[model samples]
Target: MAAMSKPYYVTTPIYYVNDKPHIGHAYTSLATDVLARWKRLEGQEVFFLTGTDEHGQKVEKAAQDAGMDPQSFTDRVSQSFRVLAERMGFSNDDFIRTTEPRHKAACQELWRRLADRGEIYLGAYEGWYAVRDEAFYGPDELIERDGVKYAPSGAPVAWVKEPSYFFRLSKWQDWLLRYYEDNRRFIAPESRRNEVISFIKGGLSDLSISRTSFRWGIPVPGDEAHVMYVWLDALTNYITAAGYPDESHPRWKFWPADVHFVGKDIIRFHTIYWPAFLEAAGLAPPKRVFAHGWWTNEGQKISKSLGNVIDPLALIDEYGLDPVRYFLLREVPFGNDGDFSRAALAGRTNGELADALGNLANRTLSLIQRNCEGKLPAPIENPHLMHDTTLHSGISDLREKVGKALEDQQFHSALEHIMFEVRYANSYITQMAPWALKKTDPVLMLQVLRLLHDALRVFGTVLWPFMPTTMDALLDQLGVPKDQRKLADLATPLPGGIPLPPPSPLFRKIELAA
Candidate 1:
């Protein structure tokens, strides 16, 4: 595909500051980071934003429980998220806190727009509110568990009655359905799209847009007594980070985000409520909102209560970053729930990161260093291949194959094809017996080694978005410059005599205690 001339904007849902950073947060952010990196590599201008949602009743209560003011509490916890992003190598371009002056301005501007359009109205809200989710549910949507009510999502809910401001969410139901029908991709994963359609068909009630009981939020534009709904203030962070209320802002080109990467739990907000708010404000909805599935630990649900919320930092410390990142996209289909296991992580590290890509890089680079005078060898003009079509066909068609896979959001498939090439390289080396070729026909050995260099060039370059650090270091070892690391450079071979860095393993095996 030709490079996109238009800018690409992607976002991870602004995480709630009520909780600390976890693997679930890392999963969404990392997936978006990969997409942002891919778009930049594709030669498109990209804006990637992620940050904390610092308001809501849940946050207010959490702060009180922590014995601190809301701002101080959010500040402390939000820094953990920022630190997590930095340590995980997330390439987020902007991190917006809702409490920031810029974000407050954006939220108020949006609220005023909706209010002017008659989409906001004074009302009282009485419903079962899930403190954990910061969401309210209808009577029919609640379930009883041991004499306590819970949202369908299993979050505990308590009755909330307060003076509130309501958004005219019901008015947009038909329009939203039509939009979904017209766009077809407004919500991703056919299953998710179907679910939204069915839910909207069942009905959409007007949404509570302001809470009078909670003062720890962006106050409603004209009414100091009410605060903007956490969802409204939170969703506006997208445009806020895009420099909303200022068309001249350079990042405004990224309005109508290319994609909103969110978890399935929040699909209702993104697919329905967020679009309604944007349309009410006379703005276009984001191109897509893809809600990915959750991760369980070792076939059991991962939860704080269970003492099994996986700490992404600890995981990275135990296993290197690239392998951990690789395992995430590789182990699960992007939109489906996955199981996390130390055993699975260690196995993939040893098997693929260590045995396949890492082992292949060392073997090929070591051959060049020992046999080719520490430089790339000359390639034969047209050499006869002695191997089967399996690998050549795969390696040759890799760019288009992987590109299509990524475009389709088939991350696992893309990584699978990449590892396929790695396996093919290993098989090809064994088939040609490059070491033996060195003694029998040194010239043919050079051809095999050159072939290995070209093949590694393709896979390593393709692997960059998935495993940036490892691929960058691997490409550097192959003598490929950073400027030439785009998708267009995948099939391009290195010049014969570029000096190389000494080879080292890209990933290490994580040994588990026996």
Candidate 2:
């Protein structure tokens, strides 16, 4: 197992602490949560991390606007993000806070190393700075809106000049391009990769790494008057969690992350600037950075004035956790923007979860309960259908396809493979007519039920990461022990005539007010 041989580390972009967590935050978390869970199910070691980005001018202003100090504000808002993660049923290994002492030490150490390596130098900077993005953009990158300048991303910007420490990012433009060229898969989805390459090719500028204008961030080592750029400070959290400066730390094994799950807006930071910073610090960049697109609520874009933003908690309340998780990944291509509508969401919940998978499990198990005397039948007494038929071959091929799809970060493709088998199982049951076979051919009926039960086993094993709780219930119906719920374990046939509990509904059709 790659996970056991070489640990898998994954991180969601540490969320900003300015507002309550939204569907956007949940989207990234859900994606990485599923990936991390899948890695663990592969019987490998995994470190799944998530946390809040506490310090920045945005946070500082938000705190002041609320009449509180930055620390209190971050602490308060950070708890909300943690609550969001917990409420969403996230199984994160660690939740890091930038305000924590260990993180502070990590940030300070990274700053000193970059400074010592000649990658950093004192400089004066003048540019259109977007506090919201914590980014400084050249005038050409800003859009004029009603006499004010906004970053291309729509965040308002201000002309600012200050003495700061700058990272020699311009010096590494060619090297960064070569890294992307040599490592073709460094940035995901092809579109994001092209965007980063174009931006770097257009030109790289030395990035201001220290901010004297903002006092709410980690201070530059040896110069308390200057604070580290929020993005720089935030990016260091990855290494801080990995125990930087102490290469022997057990967590450092996860240093070069398997993936960094981020939103499309931050692709440049992750793809261009982040890798360069790590190489300068004498560390390897994360293996892959997957930048996924945003979500629109219903048909309208989410906005504050429209009040159309999705609260993931409310979405989960209306639709169960697993359904929401499944819909997000299945509804859109992994890297494309998707629309979130209650109708679309509920349709998948009822159509896929209830009618397709849940119904298949219920009918197969109920048939076993009635005909097999509440016990799971042994592996098909007649093994032809179990090992040699088209159904068997089709399912056998799926494991490889789905694994490859996931390896490519194609979440929708992976789930599509599972659903294909699901529909096949439904058609197989219809064709077999197990209900009719029960009286005419009792022996054959028991064997058919056994085959269907085995099919459920396959679904349960592969679908566990996406729908853990529901899969647990379905696996229990097949008498699958808790410890043996992995892909490798599905091949072991169920012991003959083992007791299986009564079938319970795994997914209920959502009832909405008409």
Candidate 3:
């Protein structure tokens, strides 16, 4: 495989640290992890980043509510997110926090650049602000419910007046429109791109870039009285992971991120404010930002008051890590909202993973172990059968097919392609009647077994990025070496007579709690 010259940088938005880690956090991180691993499989250098957004008024109040100082509160909550990364098997290259000294420096430096460019100025600000969202809302955007104002998100809003530093967002309105038009794929999923364009065309207002009310954030450069806004501080975590201020650090090679995976709720901040901020700082904006939709639990909106939050840790404990990972991307189309139900997860786990994939590997390998002296059979040399030829051709074309789907971030489509091969292999084995061939024509049985082995090898290798642990164990039984698991290595045929390890179940069928 010819590797690309430039490194691929992928990031999950730094999660707000106001609450415990939930399914939304896990979904974004897992999606980014899959992309990072796939790039690595294709022989490219990859930098994956995930972290906690540790500043803002919401966090300050949360800290006080928890009876802890802001720093201590952030330290504790941020560690949980880090632990979530570990528990989910996320291969993030770095975990950043807005509270980190390196990140603070980067944020302040960006602020200075914007200010020096005449993009920032001190001003008195007043507007309806949602503390829960850390966002400002125009009167038109707020809905009155029971004589009380709430943001469109249904979060209650309160009027606040304070001296603040403002960014000249209105100045870049026309320029941003042209940028979006020139970089057609900059904002993803088509739907989100249109949403951003419409919002910008509606007219831009100067953004509040600093807050004097909350002291729990990065202090403004040359002015300690105000701290930089949370979105600005949080967004800088991307470049901070790439060594922003110094720019000479080795990791800086990954600047100008390949893609940023963010929840749709935050698309405006990322696509609008983030790019504008980077441009004001004389830096290039990230190449692409993909905003994926939310997940509802059992057809009900997930909320704390509703008591229906889907805890990913609990799901992993109940099911399995890899199964949860597979179901997450495989169950829903990319960039579309999905409903999470115990029934749907269990059905996918049992139907797709266990019945379709796991069974294919188990029965095929068991036959080879039992009938072929527990050794890997040689590749089929003379396959006059059209079924044999067709299966070989399909597996040969499988990698590129899956790659195209992933390039579009169509994760479900990528998995569907893989599962198609699995289902085909299962059907091929059944029709070939490898068990009967063992009695009628033992020689033909071995050839069929070899074909099955090759299919399994390709399946295990391609699936490694999505389900590493399970695929690792599956590949272990196939006698594939640790270093020989890249997508390029698929071109090399698996050598026969390799001592195969004893077969074991890769995924177990599980029952969810009532």
Candidate 4:
């Protein structure tokens, strides 16, 4: 495929600041980070943004319970998220906070733009509001059990009646449906697309965009009586981080993001409400909103009450950041829900990392050092016809397949393809018996070693996006220059006869205590 000339913009849903960072937060951020890293390596201009959503009734009440002002509470917790991002090695270009002055300006500007366009109107809202979800529920969307109404997710709801501002979301139903039909990739995962299309087809109601009962959010521009709803405020952060309201801003060129990665539960807000708001403001909707499934703890929903919320910091401390990042993306299909288990993590690390990749690097580098006097051997021209042809074909095929997988956002499949190459190289080494050939025919041994170097170079380049640290180690052992690491470099071999570094294990086995 030809290289993409346009910039790529991607975002993670701004996390709520009411709680500490958890595995779900880590999962989404890591996925976005991997994409950002891969795109940058593929030579695209990329922008990755992630931040905390600090405005809502939930934050207000949580602050009250904690005996501190809302800002103070949010500041303390929001830092934890920032720390988590750094701990996980997230390559985010911007970290936007709703309370930031720039974000406030963006939100106010969005409100004025929508209101001036007549998409905002005064209205009274009476419905079941779930504090846990920070969302309002229609009667039909709520479930009643034991005389109490709850959200479909089992979060308790409260009856709320207040004069509020509403966005004319209903008016865009047909436009949204037509947009979805025209842009089939707008909502990702075939299953997610059907769900979103069905929801929009059912009909969209005017969305309540302001709350009067709380003052912890961005005040509606020119109207202090109400604050913007948390969802509206949060959704605007994407544009805010890219410098909206000031089109001349340097990052503004990437506005109308290429993709917005979000959790499945909030698909309606991202796929429906967000697009309507953008259309009302005379801006283009994001190119795609891919809502991925949630991760449960040991096959059960992650909950604080259940004492099963996986702390991401704890996981990082237990396993290094890259390993954690690799496991999360490689273990589950991006949009499919899965369970997080320590045993499963250990298994991948032991089997794939230690046995396959790490051992291959150790074996190959050790052979080069032991047999070639610690000097890289130059590759013979065209080695053996059959062996050279097979190696070239396999590497070329794997590169194309991996590139396609990344383009489709199939991260797991991409990693799996690269590992398959690793497996093949290991098998080829054993079958060819390069070590024995060293004593019999030194020239043929050099040819065999050259083939190994060619394959390792390609594998290292392709694996960089997933296991960056390990890939760098492999490249260093092969004496590859940092500047030589690029997607295109996968097709070429590093010059031989350059001294290589002594090999070391890439991954150490993690033993879980009984």
Candidate 5:
């Protein structure tokens, strides 16, 4: 029997439309993009979805402040997110907007189903609410500072009491605990798992699922007087994108998403509230939810008040997309907090990209053009030589390790492994002194050139997912077929004596000013 095909379904948190796209949003999307691209390269059927969360009190207030209708405001701001995704090379298959009619229909259908199941009920809600966070807080979660009571934000919270509907979240606490205990990988990083377990152990509360105070969100089924809470409203986006509430819909085949890539701050909503919501509706929760860490700008938390929030578009415009993507994944471990700085970005691009990988390609291909008459020279087969054997064996090992790293979602490690091979190739060429060999023994020089070509071809194949355009250019210079550059071809050696083109410089060196 043939091996079964794997399915990969991934999502980034639907960004709230109250603010424009920022580095935080870009971070989540980029991480998901890398995963989706890698899985596709590995021959998995991938469904990647990302979109905007357009309905909330914060969005309403922001629209009002901007002197526009909520719909108009959201439309304009949401386009910024789409544009950013395209600019950053995101390959998401679907972009969902909560304001879309399809999503509204799905939300209404879900609400009715939960209501019919006796999971939703009317009640009064009075608590501290944060407009910025769109979250209701209990007394214990509040902090008092400077004679003002706040909901963990420095801004004072307004007291309001309103009739609302609630979800029986407390009734599902035992089930959630059992689910976590049985499925140890439900949350990520082990540390995040502990945090989530602690939060759930503190005791789950019946969640207020509807808000009578806000009229700017998805209206609750059978009750136009209230709208669904922002968390519930936002969490439904995953199923909405998969065409839920209409089981006959074609996209429903991808339901019960394989993975949801979210930020650590929102893990509770994804792990606790999202799973509970799915269970109440007789649906399966996503197979996994990986909550990744935050980023600070130059060692300080990004703050508009501090005037240091990083603009992703500006960074892309300044440094280019792949460099930004590479720096982000390479600079830090995936689940740990990282600091971003212009100096750090420049250093990695200059040292790893330009000097190491890029320069090696430039020199090797230029030598082929100048010394080998712009054609690949046939490699001399010498199984007895230790260096040749070692190079081949090392590349085969790298192929295996890179595949494992991608499977484990360790993109930084995968990229590091590829660059390590590049470094090895550069050193091999230097030690062999291929240029001198051309004068001493032309046949020996051809063998050395063949090794360089084979190394570059494999490097390009592994790198295609991370830096597509750059890798394509590198392969073109080596005269390798685009079709032959699939991920599975990493172990295959290029046929020698293929005509090559003069090497164009892959990356330019940058000088730091004194």
Candidate 6:
């Protein structure tokens, strides 16, 4: 594919500050980071944004329970997310907090625009509200169990009645349906798209845009007594980071984000409410919203009450970072709920990382270093007919195969494609017996070694987005230049006789505790 001319913009949902950073948060951020890195590799200008959503009733209550002021509470919890991003090696261009001054200014300006467009009106909101979800559910959408009401998500709800401003969300229902129909890819995974369409077809009521009961959020423009609803305030972080409220800002070119990565629970908010607000504010909706499924630990629901919340940091500490990153994206198909068992993690670590890719790299490079005196082997002008054709074909087609899979956000398939080549190279090395050939046909041995070297270069460069640190080491061992690591470079051949650094193992074999 040709290099993209327009900036490729991507974002993770700004995580709510009421909870500590968890695997769910890490999963979304990592996926976004991988996409951002891939786009940069594709020679496209990219903007990746992630951060904390510090406004909401849940945050306010959490702050009070913790005996701290709202800003102090958010400042403390928000920093944890920043730490999570760094710990995960996310390549976000900016970390936007909802409480930032620029974000507040952006939210207020959006509100003013909506109000000026006559899409806002004063109203009293009386409904079942779940503080945990920061969402409202209609009577029909609520479930009653043991004489108590709960949102569909199982979060407890209480009756809330407050004088508030409303966004004319119902007015844009038809427009949104039309938009979804026109842009079929607006909501991803087909099932999610259908869900959003079914929910909109049911009916959209005007959404409560301001809350008088909560003092923890951004105050409404011209209405100090009321604060903008948390979801509206939170969603504005996307454009705020893209320099919203100032179109002339350089980053504004990245507006109308190429994609927004969100969890499945919030698909309604991103698909239904966010677009209506943006359209009313005379701004474009995001091009796509891909809501991924959740992760369950040990085949059980992961929750704080269950004491089964999989801490990403703990996983990283126990297993290496790249292995953890690989397992999460590789273990299950994207958009499907996955089980995080130690056995599954260990299996992929040992079987794929340590044995397949790592073993291949170790054997190929060790042979070159020992036999070729740590120099890159030269590729013969005319190679062995049978052994060379298939491996070269696989390596040559790798860039296109991986690129197409990644474009559709198929992380598993992309990694699988690379692993196919790895497995093939391993089998080829065994079949050709390059070691035995060293004494018989030294020329054929060098040719076989050179083939493996070229394959490793391609693998390292393409897999860098998924496993940056390990791939960086692999590329460095191959003496690949720092600047010459783009996707386009995969087609270029390296000159022979360049000295290579000593090979080191990319992954350690992990033994799961019984």
Model 6: lDDT to the true structure: 0.91
The TM-scores, one per candidate, come to 0.96, 0.98, 0.98, 0.97, 0.95, 0.98
Tell me the tens digit of each residue's lDDT in model 4 across 1-514: 2357788899999999998899888888888887888888787889999999999999999999999999999999999999998988888999989999999999999999999999999989998899889898888888889999999879999999999999999899999999999999899888999988887777788999999998899999878999999999999999999889999999988988988999998888899989989999998899998888999888888888899889988887898766787789889998999889889898889888888878877888888898998888886566446444666567778877987887777888998888888888888888888789887888877777777777888888887777777788888888889988877666466667799889888888989899
Winner on TM-score between 1 and 2 is: 2
TM-score of 5: 0.95
How many pairs of residues in model 5 come into backbone collision? 0
Residue 59, model 1: Cα distance from true site in angstroms: 0.6
lDDT of 5 by residue, 1-514 (tens): 2212656789999999988888989998988887888777666778999999999888999999999999999999999999999998999999999999998998999899999899998989887877787777778878887777887545568776889899999999999999998888788878888988998899998998888766899998778999899889899999998888888877787888887888988888999999999998899888888888889998898888999989999988888777788889899888889999888999999999999999888888888888988888775466347356666666667767888887666778999998888889888889888889888987778777787787888887777777777778999998888777666655456667788878887766555566
Residue 354, candidate 4: how far off, in angstroms?
0.7
Q: Indicate the residue-level lDDT of 91 in model 3.
A: 100
Candidate 5: regions farther than 4 A off: 1-4, 152-156, 379-388
Q: lDDT of each structure?
A: 0.88, 0.88, 0.91, 0.86, 0.85, 0.91
Q: What tens digits encode model 1's per-residue C-alpha lDDT throughout 1-514? A: 3668788899999999998999999999998998888877777888999999999999999999999999999999999999999988999999989999999999999988888999889988898899788899888888897798889999898889999999999999999999999998788888899999999999999998888886899988879999888999999999999889897899998888988999999998999998999998899899999999999999999988899889999988878789888899999899999999989989988998889888888999999999988898965465446344455567778878787887767889988988888998998888888888888998878877887888888888788888888888898999988888887766455578888888988887888898
Model 3 poorest ten-residue lDDT run = 379-388
Ten-residue stretch with the least lDDT total in model 4: 379-388
121-184 per-residue lDDT for model 2 (tens digits): 9989998899889999987787896888889999998889999899999999999999998999
Off by over 4 Å in 2: 1-3, 385-388
lDDT at 300 for candidate 6? 98
